[model samples]
Target: MFWWFERSGEHLRLEVLQLAADKYELRVIDADGTARVETFANADDLAKRQTQLQHALSSQGWTGPHGWVM
Candidate 1:
């Protein structure tokens, strides 16, 4: 899955995918090209982290968790 948020002129994207039987990852990329990747042991942990990230971004004035499956 993929998601994005924008604030002012800055944009951010997040991509989530499974790595293996018990592994998942969330990759974050910014408009300027900086990127970060996080790994989780399972979907539950990945989901919790994604939620936290969304809340943090929202508090910072970013708009839309607008996303679609890839």
Candidate 2:
């Protein structure tokens, strides 16, 4: 599953995808999903504000290896 959010005043969009394996893919897409800035990380720990947002997701709300807990 994926949720889409448009940045307040930009043409960019943030998409949060929930995968079957408990990981996640975040894409900063343009007006259209065709063009995007992509990043991959663990879905569990996905709320940290690290310098590298991509890395932050690797351990943010991590609970287990099979599914989301938070």
Model 1 — TM-score against the truth? 0.93
Residue 43's lDDT within candidate 1 is 96
Lowest lDDT sum, 10 consecutive residues, model 2, at 61-70
lDDT of 2 at 17: 63
**Model-by-model lDDT, in order?**
0.93, 0.42
Tens digit per residue, CA lDDT, model 2, 1-70:
2333333333433455666475665554544546554444665454442224434333443221122223
What are the C-alpha RMSDs, in order, of all predicted structures?
A: 0.8, 9.9
lDDT of 1 by residue, 12-68 (tens): 999999989899999999878899999999999999999999999999899978889
- Candidate 2, pairs of clashing residues: 44-61, 44-62, 45-60, 45-61, 45-62, 46-61
